[model samples]
Target: MDTILFYTPGTCALAAIVTLEWLGQPYRLCRVQKAERQSEPFLRINPRGQVPAMLVDGRPLLESNAILAHLVDRRPELALLPRHGTWERDIANQWLAYLASAFHAAFWPMLMPQRYTLENDCQATVRQAGEEAVRRELRRVDTYLEGKDFIQGTRPSALDAYLHAMSRWGNSLVDMAKDHPNLWRHQKTMARDPAVRFGTAVERGEPPPEPHALVGHVELASITL
Candidate 1:
């Protein structure tokens, strides 16, 4: 196959998965179990031991943004992103960077609390701090999203897929409706999209109807790279 993706459950990988489906390009999904990320074979493909890794034509694209950017670039006529090098593209890149760096890191405490402290007693404190950090990031995005149908230009783009995935993570930690109405509304809007819903179901480990772009799923052992 020309394209294959390795993803862990509940990670931001959903964004890329949704993007691939949106492109309607033939691609395969390889859902990795959480423990498998640290395995020797998996590490060979991605030493950092994190997920949302894409293997396109036998080469690895390890970062989420890089994977998404490649997918978007493949089908520019769809305008999944604004035209490259434009002011709008810069703004879109800014949000993608913010989500990948600040927003994603804020969830590490909750997602991998053991890494935060050697002592188990400090876990709750670390998680509480994480919640606060997530709220801060949410506030920024929520504010920016005011009176906007999507995060970027008027149409739905890869930006919406990226935001929808991360914002769903934040919603799990806080009451988005009461604390972040705009964000809550954004979530509602994104969830209604077919691609978004398909991505959501797939990440949730459900048997979602496969999209035409989904070449099918592959086993990790079957993938050489």
Candidate 2:
């Protein structure tokens, strides 16, 4: 079960890295540079040219949600996720879906306004709109966490890792404590975890020999689950 994860700084790929850490699985990390993500070599591996591309024994896997889910599936003993055929698991899946669709979508326009509009001047408007949407969505998440320490109640799941990474994108623009205390509290709790710190440090472009434990290894030629 050799796993290789390709990621860039501060992307949702942190979720996969964190999940692997939580599972205590021996895997490899490939820190793809921002400029090289869309390069031919990476594109050949993942046509989407996205970060967090995990190669399990040489079988390329894309999509952070699916990759995280697959990790949970492979290591049920870790209880990284809720039990199968249970409402708790369903709720966890819902959170993952929301992060994949709603939470992640809100950042696109703000990060890449040109993709939303053709007019140069309208880019600001698009960015502003995106920022507002991000705030609204984040607020909703905060409200949802009013009485819950994690997305699935008391336990920290991959959803927490995903939310922690995504929430960082908004930290510069919005103060979570002042605007979204519940979510802010959750993020603070998540930050204390070594796995979360390791994933985030790598995302922040931390070089080798840092304080973090998780690090990438040599890439494999080919293998599958």
Please tell me which predicted candidate would have the highest lDDT against the true structure: 1
Write down the TM-score for model 1.
Answer: 0.95
Error of 2 at 157 (Å): 0.7
Clashes of 1: 0
Could you tell me every candidate's TM-score relative to the true structure?
A: 0.95, 0.91
Error of 2 at 63 (Å): 0.6
**Model 2 poorest ten-residue lDDT run:** 216-225
* Among all candidates shown, the one with the greatest TM-score: 1
lDDT of candidate 2 over 67-175, digit per residue (tens) = 9899998878777888889998998899889999999999999999999988999999999999999999999999989989988757788888889888878888898
Give the lowest summed-lDDT range of ten residues in model 1.
207-216
* Tens-digit lDDT string for candidate 1 (63-90): 8888888899998999999889899889
lDDT of 1 at 123: 93
Stretches of candidate 2 exceeding 4 Å from the true structure: 205-215, 218-225
**Each model's C-alpha lDDT?**
0.85, 0.83
